[model samples]
Target: MRLAHGLDINHPVHKAMVELGKRLEEKSNGQLIVKLYPSGQLGAERECLELLQIGSLDITKVSAAVLENFVSDYKVLSIPYLFRDRQHSYDFYDSTIGKDLLHKGGDYRLMGLCYYDAGSRSFYTKTKAIGSPDDLEGLKIRVQKSHMAVAMVNQLGGAPTPISWGELYTALQQGVVDGAENNLPSFFTSKHYEVCKYYSFDEHTAVPDILLIGTERWSRLNERERQWLQEAADESAIIQRELWRKAEEEALKTIKKAGVKVNYPDKHPFSEKTRAIMNMFKGDSIAQKLIRNIKSMN
Candidate 1:
């Protein structure tokens, strides 16, 4: 059977996907093969999902935030500061709610296989330090095109510019965007830290990179093949978490050496500013229920 794997090259998700493919091949004894297409070679996240809808692409890695556009229930993970800490995030992902969120995308033809930690997103600016919400005011900040992210930036009083990741460095260097937010590894690996001098560890959002397989493809697999693939993906997630932690540490070291002023800002003010945005979804009982569940978790 022909299987296509879609991902953006240089992304941590792609690194994990490559390892997962290798493991699946070994477990299947080469009977079930996977074709890897990185660097958005197949298509962007939305395009890949469109392909999945029509049964073209077999597998892909999509952000839970992006998934929210199609599967509104997936937006729960996009809520900033919803998790107490990394352990809280991981523990919740292993709970019933996590499983429900993963499967919720199936109604839209995307089936989540596992969650890959993307780490906490923090602000990095080229010429300023975002030590507090007031520091962010009037600054043109770049955020993922998610409504929640854009709203969070707005709540901080900054202009939320939705720029693609590939174009962000140029956007910053050219002064199109004053700053951008992401985890340490991404900021370092993308070399955005080179242009951005200040690294504020506000730990705004802890969105997980979700690995998904098209329901069309999954349904075509035999029970044994499905089990083998699932086990391989699960094992790869374990390996990816270990790799992510090491990457985060290395990124921090590299950025400091590059002259980035690393500051640990008090997140209390930041959280306070964005708290009211949650009210926008109050009418959605499911989302409200998720907020309650997350708050109650340890």
Candidate 2:
């Protein structure tokens, strides 16, 4: 099996993939193997998904925000303020509704294996701090190539610019974008703090990363192979969460030392600004039901 992703090799997700390969090898008694291609050697998130669909790649990981483009059900995960807290989001992923959403992409030849903790996303800017949605006025905020992300940024009163992750660093340096939003670890690892000095903990969204397998490759696996692979992936998710927690702590300390101005803005105003994003999906019954079900979770 070949697993490819766009994250750096030091990323928690990549470390978890290493764990997956080790566990799968142990479970299969050396009969099955997983080859990893990190740092977008094959392609970006969308390109990796396309490769998976055609059986050119066996597995890949992507943000739920990116997955929203291939599977409409995944749009729920990108909604701002959807999950109350980290544990709340974890519970939803382990719930039946979450499992159902995983398979919702089968018709598109994509199958979700599991969800990895991506932490929450917050805003970081180069010029001024984003204390509130009002501060975002006229600022160009970088967003992923997902409609939900675009809408969320628009709702927050910023101009949304979709750019590939690889091109973002240059884009930030050249002032093509005024700012971007992401988790602490990503901001630190990507070294965006060098250019974007202000980091705000508005934490508007807690989007998880998903491990995906193509249906074409999945169909070829025998029952035993499937069980072994699934077990490996399930265990990897647990390992990945712990790694992510540690990375977040280290990233916070490191970025602070690097002279990044970090602040904890009141989340209510930010949440309130994006509240209407839910209404954007009112016409889609699947999305509406998902919203109701997720909110009902304890």
Query: For this target, which candidate reaches the highest TM-score against the unseen true structure?
Result: 2
All candidates: TM-score: 0.94, 0.99
Q: Per-residue CA lDDT of candidate 2, range 141-176, in tens?
A: 999999989999999999999998888999999999
Whole-model alpha-carbon lDDT for candidate 1: 0.84
Number of clashing pairs per prediction, in order = 1, 0
lDDT of 1 by residue, 1-298 (tens): 3334333356566678778889999999997877787756766677777888778888877778777888888777878798889989888777898877888877788898888888999999988888899999899999886888888899988999988776788999999999999898888878888799999999989998888888998999999999989888888888888888888888889889989999999999999998888887878998899889988987
Error at 223, model 2, angstroms: 0.4
The reply for model 2, stretches above 4 Å from the true place, is: none
Cα lDDT, model 1, residue 154:
92
Name the 10 consecutive residues with the lowest summed lDDT in model 2: 274-283
Q: Provide the RMSD of all predictions against the true structure, rounded to 1 decimal.
A: 1.8, 0.8
> Model 1: clashing residue pairs?
9-39
